[model samples]
Target: MGKPVACLAVAIMILFLYYVIDVISHASGNRYKEGDPIPLYANKVAPFHNPSETYPYFDLPFCSPAHVEEKKEALGVVLNGDLLVVAPLKLDFLVDREPESICRKRLTKEEVARFRKAVLKDYFFTMYYDELPIWGFLGKFDAEGIDDSIVTSVYLFKHIHFEILYNKDRIIDVIIQGDLQNALLDVTDNKEVEVDFSYSVKWIQTDIPYEKRLEKYSQSSSLLHNMEAHWFSIINSCVTVLLLTGFLATILMRVLKNDFVNFTHDEEAVDEQEVSGWKNIHGDVFRYPRCKSLLAAAIGTGTQLFTLSIFIFMLALVGVFYQYNRGSLITALVLIYAFTSGIAGYSSASFYHMLEGKNWARNLIFTGSLFSAPLFLTFFFLNTVALAYNSTAALPSGTVVVIFLIWTLLTTPVLVLGGIAGKNSRPEFQAPCRTTNHPRQIPQLPWYRTTLPQMAMAGFFPFSAIYVELYYIFASVWDHKIYNIYSILFIVFIILLIVTAFITVALTYFQLAAEDHEWWWRSFLCGGSTGLFIYGYCWYYYGATSDMSGFLQTTFFFGYMACICYGLFLMLGAVGFRAALIFVRHIYRSIKCE
Candidate 1:
């Protein structure tokens, strides 16, 4: 007991230390004074379109420059005409006198004519600011007297200022603005079109302190000021789940206790009562599910995802990745998923073996490639479209090759090793109730107790628990808002898990009570149906909340959404199965069987 107490104390101290370190990390080295060169990175260029021509009707062609170069440590991209360049500025308070380089590409007379025609054909410039595209041509362009021979020069302007108060660290604010200046060249046109870039910095000391400045920088915009509402929803959902859990515990536990006591009485009482309901189908409860190999593979893949999600969230909580660190999250996900392939292989093989499944090779292969194949295909298609549009969002060929190598060299080998280990391990599918040679026939269930209704009921609770938080996540992803409340997200994640487990157990009990011995697939689908709700929510979000309008954006949204939904299906299915497995084993073990 003392040893256990000591271990618990040590664990508590370690956790406290971790939190302290996390706070210190955020507070330290975050100061930026005046006269610092702020780093600006370009994302992509897209054509601007009117609201009427946004979605299905929008057919504007956007492109990244054919060539990019760095001169004197300054990056530049060649632009022939008006184009929207997305250069996101970090919230670093600093100013540099050095101007960014922008190379102007001179177009021939014929090329200029083509460019003018393209511009007239609904091709306008736009830029991304605060994650939303600002139409550059809205009121900034002067189109009168513009023709083929007119020279267009683009100007990039960056302004940075510090808001400081006494005894407080200064807060930095940055604004990036661009303007297009056009002039016609005459005979003896010795004047060359030159691109001008300028930056200015200013400091203002006020009563606002550093903490307030940081808060201002990290605070959610008006559009995302639903944090309180989200918390309310979460609390409401938690109360509902708690009530359900209490009801379930009261009814199931009390009834099961009485049943166990009565059934374990004298032999005469036991014979008189006999077995009924769930006990009647005990033999079939643990029977191998049909298509056991497929189920096993899914479970394996889900386990891998579960492990990956935990680590990712922990890393996020620790501030290893942030919204400003572009692509860091994706890179971490890819590497973590690759490294966790072993868990998938091991889980799939072990579960398949437990189910007495043959086709070990097929099961192993399916486990390894089930999730990865669709992910790769979706990414490939999206990247292909991006490349065709010459968008910088497209992954480079070398990066793609590296990902392939990681999958092939590291992921695949680890999976094979894990599969071997799982196969060699002892089979441990022992059930509390002995399964007979013949499977029991499942009885028909009522409408409310049917598979579909139970799944809908089971899934609704978990989805409800997270839908509010889900909206914020969607805003952060699609709207480009910085989500800094990792602690809240982590809490909500825990709540979601609890709700999923409780709801799954309650639903599984009802199915078993209905004499539906075929609970394996039903149990899996019951929880996983949350993904359907999530997909439906996605549809609603696209049509209602999001302002994104383009064929490429639409395709990218739905295409990647499919992968996300599929992953949720696997994850929730595994969660339901594990929970139901434990519940079933507990109930069955308490029964007095002759």
Candidate 2:
């Protein structure tokens, strides 16, 4: 049975690795081929009734007539009644050239109605430039050039510039800029107006290479102002790990050596020595924690998250998610989370059984809902805010229903099956030390040695290890930057695990030494507290580094972050508890108690 289980586990891991590698190898690369149509998506359209409320793509008008194409990727939507062309603009630098209009077309009555509705609703237009989105108004243009005429002229400016700044080699940076100017459309008037559309491209070149230009551009974009800070974070983490390793080594070696000397001595001589410390509480060390049901459920959920996270990083390491693949990351996460529901159910049921809990059905139900309930509620709230604002960020009602169905149809059933299997298959909970019928009275600990302080201390090391990387992640999500360095992210993730494990074990030892046998939850909290620090950092980043403003952005930021922090809490907590459990069992087994 053991061999089969081991083999099964190995097979699953191998399969997962193969799938990730296959995806990275064959997935759509981010490079843009010649003549690929650049899609133009509109921002959220504020409702006419309430100007502040917005909904993303719903009820908005496309540049062309509403029609679904068989090949979706081949089409581009119109923005601000202007058809955006994606062809590269070539300039003749030797001689001055005539201005060329890229797109000029008349709007049909239906298209005109759609454009008018969007204008009244105040929808912003967005254009994509090499995976970067630039947002602007449809009828607004820079004040540099303007002319008054009888016919209303709506100018669509396409500014293309190339710069080569260095002497060694000419590396050019290509920039595609889009902006608009509205002359005839008035918000108060309902009359239809004819508008002339014109576009022009301007190219400028310097000696600097494209790479150097990109480096400068990246510096200005986010809080990653310097590479020194990244190096510093890595160095700090390495130092902390080394210190933790030394501390754990010294303590374990000293305690184990003392235990060996005491165990080898005669029983009479051993008893003659002082009857104090961990040995005194051996009888109650393995006693079942109060509210075992809750702990079991937490552990189960944590285990599932742990498994999911490992696979996610593994996928990321192999570059499964590239900048140009829309929704790939989110889609992967949702599917993986749904599939891993069985792991949560199984682990929870097994742990609950070991704790001698009778209500297996309740245990399973709680295990399934533990993370899912809060997640659903948080997402619902964010969706509500988006709906109220009439923003494009709001998920469609159909999508929401589909997600719910996925959870119900796919996740819940698997959880039930796995829970039943685990309940039946789980072995009895056995400890080297016998548990007492009555709970041991935990002694008073020093002020600095209490749960809160220990949690703060234990959480800091792990949080510090990844906080620097966290900055880049936040920038990519919120600041519209491209993050393609999966290899660096994978290394940071591994370091986070090491830091979490070592710090958790250290804190568990301190707690046990203080005669606190209730290490189960404490161990979990010690590692999970890292999420608290992360939240604190988020607050700091928002106030200091980020320039984001407006109710919609704020609502999305904090709302999604709440779920993220909670998930982190679960993952880190489980890691800490597992490490401490192994250490405690090892120490107890090494000692011979009468």
Candidate 3:
């Protein structure tokens, strides 16, 4: 039974590997690959004769200088080029009877009402560049709740359209913000419809000359020849080096050698040695030292990983990936990840106080170091390079100083109080009852010995963004299509949640196998390893895109993302693993004793 279960697990793992390899391999042939050209619209552009005329082919209006319709305000300012301010200060789309007339022929009255009905019912579809969607459905079905009043509301309504902001010089990610009233009819007098949406960034693809061959293999309908390939070179990836991993005897032997030993070895039931590695401050974590250290570590790592996962998904969902500029997002993600550390600190402090960690100063210092110290060199090197190149935002020195200040002044106190509250709280961890009949030390279940199943589960959450973004990016790159997948970042929220759950489950199983009943740290570590793959992929991307120069390439590649994601993922992995570990331990401890 043990052998067969192991075999099944091996088979499953192989299939998963194949799936990932296929994605990356075919990724180059993506629908909208960097260098690919955009396809021409079926109907070429003709000069618009009438100001209010409707075109025959496309639905939108012709490009116009200025013609305000009746629509309510939705978003912020719209910039013309890379510049920050170029505005009506607050400019958006003003909804009219039908969209602005670009084509010579006008839409039939029915079509005119249809446009208003669509807007009133479905609202608008937003597009952003680096976005993380945490809520709302992808705009698929027509929206609901449209009454005649909505369209007729005050005779004019408008929604602000702006690319969620992205400074090639500054690593920025915009979250999805959508809120518009549903149910509107009457399009006779363009009324002002109120909108309630939020901010972020947006994206667009330029068309390059089209080749018939491209159409044969492409999924994207739009193709232009004036394309730029980012990081997607064939020579740079270690992707081809992978071998069929059906687990040879030696492979199993190696795994067993390491894990089996760890499993069988008996550990001291109680932690006897001094709890000295990372000290909690003023007993900030809890009153006790060792327990506080463990909890703090757990919190810091878990929160960090969870947040990182959210961002990755958000970007992927939007089909926005620049291979030549891989590192740019990394750096920004790192800074964003700082927030996770703060949350972790707070969680740790709360758990520590519950466990009774004694030293307050130790809690703060150790928790801070658990995060800052480990990755300091990597971030420092990145920042130094960024400043040297005169590329991207240097995260104002004031920001760094401010961060530390916040940690000590604001974070520390919040954590301490939360810790105290935790001390007075009750355990919420609950585990499924152990129900093995005639329980065997060596069970023969296919999934019994390995944590692969759990790890696979974690993949789905992260993959959700990948699922949406991958299809779009693939279409745009390899196929040459256009999709509004990146409008909002919140779309990734649910996927992130799914991923966190998977990590927690897998970590629990790994800990159980290790028999390190003090399985918290390892649990977190196991789940946190996914971030390593992210960095690996980014590095691979950097070497792939050929058009970028060494300097522009480097700046574009690692400028915004590389530094940020690396730091962020590290912290993210730590937090995710910790969360899973602690949750498992809590549940494990509560199981009915034999």
Clashes of each: 0, 19, 147
Rank the candidate models, highest lDDT first. 2, 1, 3
What's the distance in Å from true for residue 307, model 3? 6.4
Tell me which of candidates 2 and 3 scores higher on lDDT. Answer: 2
TM-score of each: 0.74, 0.75, 0.38
Our model 3 lands, by Cα RMSD against the true structure, at: 22.1
- RMSD in Å for model 1: 8.5
Q: How do the residues 386-502 of candidate 3 rate in per-residue lDDT, one tens digit apiece?
A: 456443223346545755675566545543443443334533323333323332232333563344554444443354333333333434422214433343334333434435444
CA displacement after TM-score superposition, residue 360 of candidate 2 (Å): 1.2
Question: Distance (Å) between predicted and true CA of 11, model 1?
Answer: 21
Residue 448 alpha-carbon offset, candidate 1, angstroms: 3.5
What TM-score would you give candidate 3 relative to the actual structure?
Answer: 0.38
lDDT of 1 by residue, 524-571 (tens): 888688888898899999899877666677777888888998898888
lDDT of 2 at 186: 34
lDDT of each: 0.62, 0.64, 0.37
